[model samples]
Each structure stands twice: as C-alpha cells, then as structure tokens.
Target: MSQPEFDTYATSPRTLTVEDLQVSVGDHLVAVNGVSFQIRRGEAVGLVGESGSGKTLTCRAVLGLLPETGEVDAGTITLGEGATAVDLTGAARPTWDRVRGARIGAVFQDPGSYLNPSISVGRQLVEQLRVRGGLGRTEARERAVELFGEVGLHDPAGVFHHYPHQLSGGMLQRVLIAIAVACDPELLIADEATTALDAVIQAEILELIARLRRDHELSLLLVTHDLAVVAETCDRILVMYGGEIVESGPTEQVLTDPRHPYTRALLSVATIGDWSRRTLEVIPGQPPAAGAQMPGCRFAPRCRYAAQACLGGQVPLTEIGTGRSARCVRLDELVTDASPIPDRIEASA
Candidate 1:
C-alpha cells in the first residue's frame, strides 16, 4: 500500500487534541495525571517544567517509547486524518510503527546518546530511512545527503563518512536533526534538544529547528524548562507541575499575565536579567516524590497563597480567560494581591 498522505491531513488545519491523560509507572504511582492540550498544524506548543515534572514522560507516551514501568491509565490523543481522526491512545504498536517516524518525528536531548557512537553518521541516517521509512538503500543515501544539507551541515559528503565520535557536539546534533526530519514528519517533538550545547550553539540549533518548521509547515511540541527558550520559540506554552498541567495559554499571555502561583513563581525565577545583584530564586521545597500520593493540590504544599480550598481536594483545570486555563482556586485573588512574592529558590542539582 502507498504511504498515507499524512501531510494533506496535517495541512488541513486540524487540531491535535489530548484529553484526561493519566500515566502510571506501576500499579499505583501516577507519573502524568490529567494532562491535556492541543497543537494545531503549523503551530508550536511548548511543555515547560522542572526535571521530573513528567514533561519527558508525556512526550514519551506520545512517541510510544514510554519506559517498561510506565502505563497509560487513561487518556485520548486524537490526530487529524484528512476529515477523519486516529485515536492514538490504546492503539497497538503495529499501528504506531507506521506513524512514529513517518508522520511524527522526535528530537531527543543528548544527541551523543541518541546516535550510535560506532556507526558512521551517514550509515545511521540511511539505515533509519530504509528500515523505518521504507526507502531503498540508494534512495536513502541520496535523501540523507539532502537532509544533511537541509540542516545546514557543511560538506554533506565529508560528514556522511565521519563517525558520530568524529563530529563536534553541534555538528552531531545537526546530523541527528537531519535524521529526524528525513521523512518530513508532520509533528516534531523536541525534548530539550539544545540543553547540552553552549549558548551560541544553542541559539543556532533553536533557529535551525524554527527554520525547518517554517519551511516545512510542521507542527512542533517543544519541551524545555528554560522560559527564555519558550519565549523565543513557542507560540503556546503549558506549565506542568507534579505530573499535571498547572497553567496553559498563549505564550505571551501566560508569561506577561500569569494566573497560577506556580506559573508566576516560575516566571519570576526564569527572568534572566538582574543576576548581578540578585541571586537566582526557585520555587521553595522540592517536587513531590513520584511514589508519594497527596490528597489535595500537589502544588499546594509549596504555594505561598495556598488555602483551605487547595487542601480540600484536587482543583480541576479552570478556564481563567480565552484559551487560558490554570489549576488554582484563588487565581484571580492571587493575581491582585500584593503579598511579597519570594525570589526563585536555588534548586539543588
């Protein structure tokens, strides 16, 4: 059978809807609870939070690469299908195998680890094209060169012959990106792909991804903790905490007029300027342990404005404005109150 025309569906301007996503590591411990959002074709959505906040796990679930311990307890992930739709959750691996790399591609953090150290970069790239994408070896090599050039790698032929260890960090990352986009996947998931690079290289990598997205009219799910990165790259942002979405909205709205205390705290700490006179502040207290269970709001323990409402039960994600939602009880009051907000706490490594 011919490859499904996913691009046509992608370009039809449909929404990628996720609802009531709950994932568990084992029988009792939940890693992602009630996570939901939408990514429209040709738009960028960012998932932001500290490490262990389930950002990575959520993306992994979508990619069908969840750890062996992880299980999807409940959720619905719908991808547009040319006037139809594909329900991603509960779909078998065989079904996902067709979509994973062809229609959706992922750029993971740590390019060094993602790429095989012993294999030539060209060989790895071509191998993926042949096995996963169903291209012949000769066709794959031809496409691989084009991909290398597309990602701004100089001397595609020379780099093709080099092993992963022979390339610099930035070059290796670019090569990995080339592999991910080889098939022109409709959705691209970038999980902190630029974190390990230096600032200058980081900027270059981000720009490259943005350029590729624009050029291909691709939808993006960018996962990162850096608010600055979100500000620069994302059209919409979702703030996650303790495995749930705490705040979500247009990037500008959430950053400028934050609703949740946790979202505000994250923004206050992520602001990059004034570092000389002020120490970097972080949210007070560590995130709850994965195995631990809580009765009320998970963020209530660290939230300065937490009240009886927070301690009573789980706060549903409430719509505070058009296309904006947050899981906090006193959201309006918290925005207006002039209580001294603490500086970002320095999180431990």
Candidate 2:
C-alpha cells in the first residue's frame, strides 16, 4: 500500500523519503514509531531531540546500519524518485553496499572512533576512493589530497601524511567530512558531526558543512540535540520526542514560534542565538523511556499544560497552520488564543 506522504512527495524530485518507519530493539521494544519525513534534493533538514529521543535510531534505519538487536518492523524507506526509487526496507546486502557510502554517506559525532588509528587518515580515504570510487591508486592519492584541501584543512599535502592520533579533533573531523563527500554522494547524514569539537572549531565545521552542501548540492539530514545548531544550518526542522516527531516545519517558524510544548521547552533551554550564553530554563523531567507504551501524548507527563483531555486518547499530528504540524490535542485552542504559547501553557498547567 502507498502512504500519503510517499504519494505526495514521490512526484517531486526528492532524495530520500521515509514513510511510517518503525524500528524495534529486541523482541518488543519499538524505539522508533510511525516516523515519516522527506528530504528534497539539496535540502538540509534537521532532526532535533534530546538523548534517547530516537533521532539516531531513525537515521540508522535509513542507513541500514541498525544494531544486531534492532530491526525495522514496519514501513518503507524509499531512495530516489519514480521508477528509479529503491525501497530500503528489504534491500539485500549487495543493494545496501552500493547505496551506503556511495549513494548516501554518513558522519558521526566522534570522528576518532570511526577512523583507523594505525593508518594515515589520508590513506584510509584513499582506500575508499579506490575501492568504492573505482579510481586508480595515483588518482586516489591526488584526489584525497584535493579533498583535504576542500574541507579547509591547512596544508592539505602535509595533513595527508598525519595519522589520526597526530591530528587535532578538528582536523580529524575535517578528514571524516572529506571522506564522506569523497564519492560525491547525493545524500549526507551527519549525526552530531560537530558535537565533539570545541566552540570555535564547531562553528568552523558547521560552516564547512554549509559550504559543502551548497557547493555539492547534497541533501543533508543533520541530527543533533541542539536547536541553535539547526536554526543556523537547516532549511527545515523535525522535533522528536519519545520516539515520535512531535512537531515539524521550517526552521525559522519552528524556532520563533514553536507549537509543541517540548519544542518550546527546548527553545527555552537552548543556547541563545549568538552562542554567548545558554538559557537556564530546563524541562522538568527526563524524556520517556524508548519504546515505552503510552496512552496519549508521550510528552504529557512533563508538559505543564497537560490535562485530562490530553491523557484521554491518542494525539495525532494535525495541521495547525501553513506547512506546520504539531501532535497536541490542545493545539487548536492554544494556537487560536492571542497570548504566547509558553505563557498560556504555563498559566494553564
């Protein structure tokens, strides 16, 4: 059966579309539930959530790298569009080998962990270029060095000879970026790619990613816990909570006027736009345990405005305005009121 989102987005020139994706760990724990989203060609989308919000799990599902205990129990993940679209839900290993890294690349939070400590970082990239990219050894070396320079590593030739241990954290991250984009993949999944770097270096890495996206015309799925990062780098945002996308829309609209209480709470505690200081406000409780069954909204337990009605039944994501949706029963009431959402939620709760 075709999904509404799939049918709606398939007509467009999209790079990736994940429809009704449900990921489960072990026998019964469903970590990601009914999650659906699409990334357009050259579009940068942010997947924002706290730890254990299933953001990374969702990305892993798309990458076909789920853990041994994890499996996609339901839904379809389609890459490309129309006749060329490949459904990743049941793709064989050989199909995955061709798609991952070559067609769709990924970079993680810890660059060091992903790299080989013994080998020169440049040599490692060269191996991928030769093996996956099918370039001659000499061509691979020259291309690897060129890539190093492209990612803003100073003295590209010199950096090529440095081992992972010898390079600074920032340098190693740049190497990972170079490797990820080496194949000229159409889609890039950056899972907290800048989380391990210092503030200055983090900004530099983020700038490089933005530049790469523009220069390469790559579709990006950037996963992170920070809203400010998404606000700066993403075209659209998906706010996840308790293994579901609680809210989604344009970055500016979501940041400036968040519809979901969880999103509002995130914004309150987020680092200020200037990165000068972080807001001290904190969400009252930890995120719900992954795969924990709930009767109504998963965030209701912590939401100040949660009421009996909120807990009475399921809360489906409903359209509140143009190009925006929120999974809250009281969204209509809250959005219609003239007062601020947070203020009203505070007073009501």
Candidate 3:
C-alpha cells in the first residue's frame, strides 16, 4: 500500500522539515517511529511527552547526536530553505558537523556534561564564538562577555573566568544558552534545558529563550515534559506517546481541550490546583519498550477506551478541529466524552 501524503500537515514554510523520521537502536529497537513535524522561521514548537516517549531522541536526530548504536532507519530530515532540502538521515557526519553548532544550535539537558571541566567558562564561550561564529579571538572574547550578560549571568567577567564546576546549575544553564545562541542560529533545539533549575530560575530561563527568539527571529524546537512550560512558551505543541506523536495543535487549543487520551493523561499530571477532595489520575502503565514491536497504536494497551480496531491496523492522524490532529481509533468518542481530569493532581511542588 502507498503511504499517505504529508503535505496536508505542512503548515509552515520553514527551513526545517522532519518528515517521517524513524530512529532505531540496532536492528530491533526503535526509539522514534515515523515522527513528522515542521519548524518555521520565527516560531516556537514544543514536543512534550513522558519519560522515554521519544521527545529527546527526535530532537537528537535533528541535531545529528544519535548514539553510534542508533541509526535513522527511515524517512527524511530536510534543513534549509527552498524546494530543494538537505536529506540528513544517512548523510555524512561532516555535513551535520558543519551545521550542528553553527546554523543549528542545541542546548542540552545538563550544561555540565557539555562543558569542558578544565576550561574556564569564558574560554569555552570564546572557542564556540571562534569556531561557530567565525570571530577573531579578541572579537570572540568581547562577544562571550556580551553573551554572558545577555543570559543574565551575574558578574559576567568573574563568571567567565571561573570553571564550570564553580558555577551554580542555573548559571551553567545560562552559559549553555549563551554558547548555543552565540552565532545567532536560524534554528535552536533545547532539550529539557531548564529541567534542573528551580521554579523561579526555570521561569527566567524560559523568558530568556522566548525573548531571544523574538529579538533574533529564530526558530525554536523545545523538547520537554512540562505542559505548563509548553502553554507558556510554544506556538504549536506536539504530544508524543510511545514513539509517535499522538496529538498536535495550537498550544492553547491543545491545552484547553485535548483530543487524545494520552494527552489528557499528561495534562492531568502536570496541572496543579486544589486536590483536597479529588483523586489524582495517572496513566496506569509505563511506556512500551523500545525493543517491542507492535501493530496499530502503541498506546492501545493502556487506553481505557481502546477497541479491537485500535489493534487491527495502523492508526492515522485525523483532524478533529481546525489545525488539530490526533492518532486514535475512537477519536470522536474520546473528544465528546473526554472525562474531566481532577482540578489538582498533587499539591504544587
């Protein structure tokens, strides 16, 4: 049978296109299965999911950071503008090397892992400026200091001179952001970039990224598990379950009225309010193993309203409302009789 055309969901005229991307570990384990999304110029897209839901793996594939054990089994990852797109799935390492930190920047989950322990933060930032931004040593130094200030690091000069270990988690995260945005990349991928910080710090980091995107007209792809963060920052949100996107729509619409069971389950956990009289709802089982191959919807096993049809064949993403889509067999039932999640899950942390 022929595959369905994806142009129907190509809502953006962006330089980045992830078309049916599939990443697997060895021959049997698939971390990401047939994921498709687009990142347009000057827009922010959020990929939200529970742990092991392929959010990070999807972003890593785009950045060419998939482990050596992993491979892009199917699909195309196109970058840049025009009708002609760069096919990055099985491309040479040098091709992605040229674009990774230059044209496309990435802010990883932990800043310390990315930073060299021996080098002073200033030197690291300067090196990125020199290599990625193509600036002279003196010019790079100036830019590094300016970037430090931009990311809200205190005593920019002093922090620059200190090593990564000397800086706090929040400070290191700022430095990572500085390095990622050094060259003013056209696209930025932040993978749980603020997960380690406190609430106040996370807010600041989110605001910083938002401001940077607006001021520089940058396209952002944020991978996170926080629904609140997506609501606050992203223009469009994709909800991933198992290894594929289960639902996607404008952030506000998706949050306000989710059409997928998995999405509703996720929002149920993330949203906090009064929980005194209600029981918290949690998705019963863990995500299926990456090694486990299955037909139909991977989420069917855990879905409360799943039918035999859900396991009979592949489920297609169907549009439920304007600019909204969900991959479900009983999408109409799920939407019409979507149960009300409790006002509060657990008390706000």
Quick one: how many clashes does candidate 2 have?
A: 0
lDDT per residue for candidate 2 within 19-103, as digits (tens), equals 9999999876989999998998778889998899999999999999999999999999999888878889978999998888788
1-349 in candidate 1: lDDT tens per residue?
Answer: 1112223333446547788898899766988998988787778888998889999989988887888889888998877656657788978988888777877888877888988888899999998799788899899999898889889899998899999888888998899888888888888999999888899999999999989887998889999999888888887889999999999988877877788888888977876444464666778899987757888889888977776677777888998766789998776655434555544323222
Question: Model 2: how far is 193 from its true place, Å?
Answer: 0.8
How does residue 151 of candidate 2 score in lDDT? 95
The CA lDDT at 141 in model 2 is: 100
What TM-score would every model get versus the actual structure? 0.90, 0.92, 0.90
Candidate 1 regions exceeding 4 Å error are 1-12, 82-84, 273-278, 336-349
Q: Rank the candidates by lDDT, best first.
A: 2, 1, 3
lDDT over C-alpha atoms for residue 152 of model 1: 87
Candidate with better TM-score, 1 vs 2? 2
The top-ranked prediction according to lDDT is 2
Tens digits of per-residue lDDT, candidate 3, 18-61, equal 98988998765988888998877777888999998989888878
Where model 2 places Cα greater than 4 Å from the true spot, the runs are: 1-12, 274-279, 335-349
lDDT of 1 at 89: 92
Model 1 clash pairs are: 281-344, 281-345, 282-344, 282-345
